[model samples]
Target: MAFEGLASKLQETIKKLKGKGKLSEKDIKEAMREVKLALLEADVNFKVVKNFVKDVSEKCLGNEVLESLTPGQQVIKIVNDELTKLMGESESKLELNSNGISVIMLVGLQGAGKTTMAGKLALKLRKDNKKPLLVACDVYRPAAIKQLQVVGKSIDIPVFTMGDQTSPVDIAKASIEHAKSIGCNVVIVDTAGRLHIDEELMDELKDIKEYVNPNEILLVVDSMTGQDAVNVAESFNSKLELSGVILTKLDGDTRGGAALSIRAMTEKPIKFVGMGEKMSDLETFYPERMASRILGMGDVLSLIEKAQEAIDEEKAQELGNRMLNQEFNFEDFLSMLEQMKNLGPLGKILEMMPGANAKELKDLDLSQGEKEMSKIESIIHSMTLEERRKPSIIIASPSRKKRIANGSGTSIQEVNKILKHYELMKKTMKNMKGMQKGMQKKMKKGLFGKLPF
Candidate 1:
């Protein structure tokens, strides 16, 4: 949804190469120019665009456009590969010392979700069987400590906070001591954010780093800030020698420039991304999947990776068989949705795609629907096992709809929509499976060819 515009644009461009027997110099040059303009219009960084286009040209030029392929696809593949390389080859992982307490210091600009990300990391660390303690080092923002407290409470993790009365350095030192006392192995210290580049903020962070001797110094940056974020990252790296970045607000209207430029600019790999404000919305950054999404190719790799991380292999295999057999139901739908949350927020997934801007995804704002989904899940959970296996039984029971709505804190209309969508998906998948072979090949070719005047 977020990538519809970008998808259309790229598809239009790639269409020209659909049936080409060979590519001339003119064809490659013209196509590359068009791609350059598109990237610029999409708000990609100027220098990044230049370097990317050049790299793609160098990699793809003079290569034969095979009899079965068009020249455009060759360029697209090159671009995708280079983009992946530019971001980083493998997924970055935050190091945690197993033998002793691992301290992480988080620094970022104001409103970059530093406090929320701290709690998310703590939750992830906890799930990994490590005893994680959250340190509230933000002695600046009045509500920052309370925000961390709420996040910590929701995740059931310990919060080491001194409120706004103490210095951040002192608080961080005390927090590490507290972690030792409590036998916690991980301490994620959430530090203060500044409005802009300021000595006070840097000095404060430097002091905290010196005192805590953190294992990881992660800089959280807003992806929507674009080039500004690159500048901030550069500054932070120069001052603190940051280990990595945590790109935040990626669910918003962002051009992806920050993600593309930060690594090249600061030489620090992005370890994670904060997709949403929810405690479960943080995710590990994967460059290849992101490259695929940006190129409008879809990211099946990320989907597979997420499934592996959150769902059992046997269960997922069973679900895949059910899908192939057109037996996907509400039960399967609920499981997939829950697994998706573990991957990252829905909005962030959309943003990772080329055409999935924030504006087109306005209707897909899941934050507001959190309560509704919870209720729907509860209502579904309350249904009899037989009813869940066979939704048709509930369809005949009109009173069942009202009962579920009331029990789940939703309206009858919401329940109906879910049921309708579920049925429609089943029917669609069934039809798709039986579709004619080579239909995709025919569809790839234009229905009409233009006349040469």
Candidate 2:
């Protein structure tokens, strides 16, 4: 959803180009002109847009692209390449010391989500077998230290707080000794953020940097702030010599101007992006995959990674085996829904899919879908164990169906529909398995023999 507006506009422009069998110089120029306007309308920096359009236009005009049979496709590729290059071409890994503990200082303006990001990063590092210590250096903001401690507790990570009385510089220096005592391989200092950039704030941040000499100085910027986020990154980079940047609120940034322009403007790689408020929502910034998504191409790699993280492989394989044997029941259905919930919102998951137009799904009531899922879950939960294992009993007994409907607070028609759908799913899975095994006999037997439908 981050780049929905920009993606829709760019995809529309590319759609027209793809429709063409051949392209003329004038046609390419016209398309580039539209692309330029699209970028500008997305709130991308004027200078960045100007340079991007110029670079894309020059590449489109080259004979390598123009002389091709599919010139339009070639031109789109050039745009994708330029977009990837605009953001850093590859992932900017955090600078971690192999032999010693790594200290990372998070700096940003207030409301940029520095504290939350510290927890997110710690959660990620913990997954990599690193003992991460979250240091609370945000003494200015009310209850900032308490906020950090709360975040650390939720994730089961250690928090090193010196309270609000100690200076941040002193706190930062002391946190290292704390991390060493606790055997923490990584220390993430959640520094204070101001309402706006000021000399006092910069000096305090500089003081922490001088005291700790952190391996990575990450600037957290809110992507929804547009060019203001870029300016903030530039300012921070000038003073801190930032190792990288982290774009927060990216999921809500429909225009995505900051994501598109910050790295190019500040000459700092965007190390990560906060996709949502959940601690697991923080993701490493991948420019090529982002460009692919912007161009209406799905990010299959990220989709797969989400699946790997959310789904249990053993359970998945066992479920598949049971489905193939026509043993899938309401229990398995409930388990599948639980796994899907862990994958995040359905709308967000759909966005990562190829050809899933974010604009088209913009009007979809996700909460309504969630409510429906809850209703279905309640209906299933109301069923007896035997009824859940063998839905055929419910199909034969109207009284039982009515009892379940009453129990789930629904009508008998809805209960019957669930049974019918369950049978359909069972038959469908058998057919799919039979096809996978290249056995027509199994498919034929499963298709028309015992199924009530």
Candidate 3:
């Protein structure tokens, strides 16, 4: 959703090229012109867009593409490669000191969501088997320290605070000693922020940097600010020599200017991006995967990673076996539904799939789909344990269907539809089982002989 407008425009331009069997210079120029306009409309830096178009146009006109059998696909690959290079080319990992404690100081303007990112980073570190201590160095804003404490408590991590009476510089200096005593290997300092950049804010941040000698100084920025976010990163880099950047609010209706321009402008990699408001929504930045998503190629790797993190492998295997054996009842359906919900929103999952039409995705009413799932879940919940295990009983008894409808606040017709669908699924599974057996018999008869097992 971050680059909805830009992605749509770029995909449309590429689709035209893909339709052609041979690409002329005129076609490449027209496509590049459309791409240039799209990037400018998305609020990317003007100079960056100019250079990007010039480079892409030169490559498109080359013999390697113009003379190729699959010229259209070749052009798309060039664009994808250029886009990846424009962003960071690869993921940038955090610089963790394995020998001793590592300090990470977060700096940004007010409303950039630094405090929340601190907690997210700490939780991620804990999952990586590190003991993290959150230091509340933001003493200027009202309730800043309290907010950090609440975030740390929610994650079951320790927080170090010395109240508003102490200077942030001194607070950061002392938090390290506390971390050492508590055996914390990572120290995250949440520094103060101003509404705008000023000498006063820079001085305090620089002081903290000098005192702590932090291994990483990450600047958290709001991606929705467009070119303003780029300017903020430039100013901070000039002053503090920032190690990297973290873009927040990426899940919102942003034009994606900062994400596309920051690395080329500042020569710093984006370490992470805030995808949602949940504490677990922070994701490592992957430039190639993002370019693939923008070009409508999808990102299957990230989707697989999310599924691995959210679903239990044992439960998944058991459910698969049950479904193939035609033993999948309402109870298994309910369990499967819950597991799918853990992999984030349905819209996001759809976006990760290859060949998903952009216009169709935009027109889809995903909230309606969510409501339907809730309806199905409620209907399943209203059934008795025996009825769930053996759906035949519910189908045979009209009174039981009426009772379930009343309990779930639905009509009898809806209940009947669910029963019909379940029966259809079981029948399909049985057909699949028979087909598999037939294939095995054919293999034993030497029809397929000596498979590469």
Candidate 4:
């Protein structure tokens, strides 16, 4: 969703190149021109866009690409490579101090989701087996300390806070000793931010930096701010010598600017990205994987990782066996829906699919799909246990359908649609089971020589 417009345009431009069996210099020039426009329209910094286009165009014009068996694919690969390089070329992990507590100072302008990011990062570190302490250092904003406390409490992390009367520099310094006493291996200082970059803000941040000597000075930036985000990063880097950046609000209607421009502009790798408002939505930023997604090449690795984290392997296997054995029912279907919800939104899953057309996905009303899923869940929940296990009974009785419709607050026709869909799914599983049995019989007869009889 962040790069919807740019991805659509880039995919369309590449599609034309893919259709051409051979490419001429003129063809590549035209494609590059289109790409240049797309990036600019995406609000990518002008200098970054220029350098990206120049590099891609030169690579595409190379003889290796021009004479390749599949010139179109070669060109796409070159674009992908350039895109990755533009976004820091690799993942930049947090440089924690192995010997003692790692201090990370988070700095950003106001309204960049800094407080929430602190909780997310601490939670992530805790999952990695580190005891993390969150320090509330934002003494200026109203309720800033309270916000940090609430966030830390929700995540079950300790939040070290002095009152708003204390200077942030002093609060940050005190948090370290507090962390040491509690055996926290990592201390994340949530610093204050101003409406804009100012000397007072920088001086205060500098004071905290001087006091803490943090292992990381990560600048939290709102990715939706486009070039302004880049400018903020540049200013902060100039003052603080930042270790990395954490982009927030990337799930919003972002134009793909900050993510593409920050690293090229500031020479800092993006450490993490805030994908949603949920505490668990912070994801490690992988340049190669992001490039693949931008090129319509699907981030299968991230998708699989998400599945492994969210889906229970035992439950998934049981569900799979039930489906293959043609025993899937409304109960199983409900379980499947709950599992799917854990994988995140359907639109995001679609975005990770290989060759998914951004325009086509945009045309789909994903919110409506979410509502339909809720409706289906409601309809299923309204059914009796017997009806759930044996949907055939509901199918045969109109009165049963009427009862379910009334319980779910829907029309009978809607209830009927759900029943029909369930029947179709069961029929499909039955047919697949038959095909599998047939294949197994043939395999035993031919490959195993009648099982050594």
How much lDDT does candidate 1 score? 0.76
Return whichever of 1 and 3 wins on lDDT. Answer: 3
TM-score (all chains, Cα) for each model: 0.74, 0.92, 0.94, 0.92
Question: Global CA lDDT of candidate 3, please?
Answer: 0.92
| Cα lDDT of model 1 by residue, 1-453, tens digit | 322344345555655754466776677677778777766665667888898888776666755543326566676777778888878877988877869889998888888878888888888777779898988888778888898888889889989987799888888889877999998999998888885468877888889889888889999998877788888888888888999999887755345667877887778999987766677667788888777776666666666655577776787788878886877766886786676556665555555545443334545666766666666688788676777778887778889888877877777888787788778878877787777435765665545344343
Candidate RMSDs in order? 10.4, 5.2, 2.8, 2.3
Give the C-alpha lDDT of model 4: 0.92
Question: How many clashes show up per model?
Answer: 5, 0, 0, 0
- Candidate 4 lDDT, 239-346, residue by residue in tens: 889999999988884479999999999999999999988899999999999999888999999999999988999999999999888788999999999998999999
Model 3 Cα lDDT, one tens digit per residue, 1-453: 768888888999999998999999999999999999999998999988998999999999999999999998999899999999999999999998988999999999998999999999999889889999999998889999999999999989999999999999999999999999999999999998864458987988888999999999999999999889899999999989999999998877447888999999999999999989889898999999989988889999999999998999999999989989999999999999999988998888888888755666788999998998899999999999999999999999999999999999999999999999999999999999999999899878786467665
**Lowest lDDT 10-residue stretch of candidate 1:** 1-10
Residue pair clashes in candidate 3: none
lDDT of 2 by residue, 64-174 (tens): 887889877897789999999999999999889987789999998988899999999999999888889999999989989999999999999999988899999999999
> Would you list the clashing residue pairs of candidate 4?
none
Clashing pairs in 2: none
